[model samples]
Target: MIRCRQFYLGYPNSATVSHLLTWSHWIELLKIDDVLERSFYEQQTLLERWSVRELIQQKESALFLRLAASKDKAGVLQLATQGQQIEQPADLLRKPYIFEFLKIPEPYQIAETQLETLLCDHLQPFLLELGKGFTFVGRQYRITLNNRHYKVDLVFYHRILRCFVLIDLKINEVQHQDIGQVNMYFGYFAQEENIEGDNPPIGIILSRNKDELLIEYATYQMNSQLFVQKYQLYLPNQEDLRRELELTLREGTENASQSAKTLLDENDDT
Candidate 1:
């Protein structure tokens, strides 16, 4: 169609010329109106080799918006050009991870055991949702210290980061004790499990709710790479995500402009 032709004509230097993507993938990507968003999908599809179905599903879930939410203008633009560059640990994280595949009903008051079971039952989709380079190691992995046995909810090895990812699932909001416990797990993994090439293990607490202030206080001055992220049982509202991304980018731009103006004003005073 005219739109498709215009897309190709507008971004002649795009990854569209590559043989990695098929016509079906292009058809799905063509639905995206934002050139930056479409370019991001195109680059990700080429890099990850996502099937047409997966491409459509990612688009529906607003993956780009979620990834762009925390990024500045340059980072957002880099996503369009380079897809996702997993050069560091934080790049592997997605805020408010989607778990619609779990198919849990209302009230959502499930026990931790039941929740872990559901995640194991739907492991494949969970891994995909967790993003790239994750391979499952075990569930209920046991760690012993001072004759006491402790079990971690889930364990995964991130090939890209070359580290172990320990996940602790909390049915409620994460508490201060939870952060301390995971940091303990990180110490165990770092000292006991890490091999010659392995980096220090990272710990994550996946909970229904997170108290930002609580987490900030809990993680203050901690040496470990620990994160507390919220997970929803349903897909996110794309419109809300879009608006949030816009607001975040606007704030980043304004902050950058303010900093530049302050520097210029100081120079003028000199």
Candidate 2:
């Protein structure tokens, strides 16, 4: 019989452990590898009071690295413990969305329509990929302008963010035109469709690839409601992502350190 003797041996002070998290949370924490990663989950589980199933899903999806994509170590820790409170607009943008649940293979690209259909067929899993608090509003959501009708690829309302999310699909790498078009969509929704007291509609141009520089510049200069993100049809090699993630985190930390040192040096001279 396999016993969690190692687990108990590490945290022999049961009362201290019990004061922090329940036995179920400790069981979930035992699954993670790194001390920091386990700690993040443990803290999040205790704070969010996530059921065992939610903890398993978060771990399986690599939630640590997902939030870490945009945030620093302390920020990621705060998010895990305090929960995602969308204070800034950037809080809504999580990059490199994985659509492994789409069940589509590579080298066989599907059009926006087919992709929409597949997503509808696999709604539950897709919703998980779309993140929490998103309710499907319908595919091919239509609006009219200048006596012409147009339909968006997908639509969802984020309960937490409190905005209508307009999504347009692109099989190719995102272009400036795509940004412009989705911006138009955002404008249209904000101008015509939005009900009273609703936040302005947020637009996302989902594509396979994009000029990262262009995406940043375009989204920044354009309306704040516009965003560009990529989706992978197949599941990413998590091992590769994890390795690349370590390199990215290290680079980010070093860059922050250098910037801090430069600022302090400038202050000393001035």
Candidate 3:
């Protein structure tokens, strides 16, 4: 029988065992520590796939606090992880966004009949409002479908979205039929114009009045892509805008505090 010494009892690599065991306990403790704590380092390292240096930059920039400020936490997470992989990147939330199409120099008072002409005159700005990667295909595009003629107010092709955006300008209240009509337009565009990789065309109706309930029901049933936004000829009250900003700020702060507390609790339980 071979006599084994205490140091060489288990394995041939005695020095290797000593080296690994010396630090192994601390490493295991760290793994348990990470499991027991919701460290920002661990969360960010997993989520953002950040390098040590990038993690430092994110901390310096207060990225987590900024992310916590979002009204939609899921959307913020998606943005952080995927970086805005939207098929149709609409500016649905960008209030007071610049209306480049409406910019006209003073002393050049143009008639309402010349609205389309004026828009064409400053087509660049109009295209910008329509969103990036948009090209002016045509205005007053006439489509003959099902033995009926339909005239689209404005037609644009969005390169990034890889889809077409059909816009209908309305100076009055948006009716249920109006929504149906735009949805029909979307269907037509999807069937007739959309390429293989392109997303379904998006239809937008910019009207003076939009009925929330009506819009809700209209969009609920239809699989066709569409959005409706109310437009104002004049800017809103500055005081009202300021009050809204203040309220949003307060709400965001409160929500952030609550989220942090919840995270801390989960960590404690762990």
Candidate 4:
């Protein structure tokens, strides 16, 4: 009662007051312990106009942590107020795009056809994994150039980003050739399908495992917007995600510290 009265007096705008007094809204905010994080979610709820279900999904998916963990260094203010802003190509990508919804056995070495079939079979869950604002275009979409035919595994139009995204499925570890092929796919889209209003197409190679060493060596000089992500057949354990999130946060802090020291050293040298 005291808190509510204080809240009423502390900020007197009716819109803010209504939001503060909403029991469900307060309940959602109470779910998080960190004050900054709670405030971020509150801002997201207001800006995104998320329903109760959407709020739960955001929490369960660890959306804030996942976005924060990216090398892009999006701060709390960005997460709170921006509401998943796509400032650049990298912002649209996740490190390990989760695909536990496919329901395939973890040990099963499934063929590419079967995997694609399963994705199309459960398209709704696939879109959720794909991220917000994706509309399915087709599976195995065909595009012909120079008297030859090429097939894209899965095609989607990201409504928010306003671009065509082409995904190729690989049932094995990602290789340099996978990047090459996806680049070609994007090239085809850029030439033929991408019209004036559309952004250059984005390509993703979804593989059973990501070969970090190979990816680093091959993609170091590559400028194309191609990404390779590993997919798991099972949903990751919630505890495991929490641990990973903590580690990522620590790593991000250390990286930022290192960057600041390097800048200071450079200034001293000059």
RMSD of each predicted structure: 2.3, 3.7, 16.3, 4.6
Model 1 stretches with alpha carbons more than 4 Å out: 1-16, 252-270
Q: Which candidate model has the greater lDDT, 2 or 4?
A: 2
Ranked by TM-score, the better of candidates 1 and 2 is 1
lDDT winner between 2 and 3, please give it: 2
Per-candidate Cα lDDT values, in order, are 0.87, 0.75, 0.57, 0.72
- Structural similarity to truth (TM-score) of each candidate: 0.90, 0.80, 0.59, 0.75
Better of 2 and 4 by TM-score: 2
Q: Which ten residues in a row have the lowest lDDT in candidate 3?
A: 29-38
Model 4 worst lDDT run, 10 consecutive residues: 68-77
Question: lDDT by residue for model 2 over 112-189, one digit each (tens)?
Answer: 889878888998767766666689998998888999987888999987777898988888888777887788888788
Model 1 C-alpha lDDT per residue in residues 66-131, reported as the tens digit of each score: 889778888888998899989887888787788888888876778999989999999977887888
Error of 2 at 205 (Å): 1.2
Error (Å) of candidate 2 at residue 22 is 8.2
* Candidate 4 to truth, TM: 0.75
Candidates sorted on lDDT, descending? 1, 2, 4, 3
Which pairs, if any, clash in model 4?
Answer: none
Q: Candidate 4: how large is its RMSD?
A: 4.6
| Per-residue error (Å), model 4, residue 136 | 1.7
In model 1, how many backbone clashes occur? 0
User: Candidate 4, 150: how far from true, in Å?
Assistant: 1.7
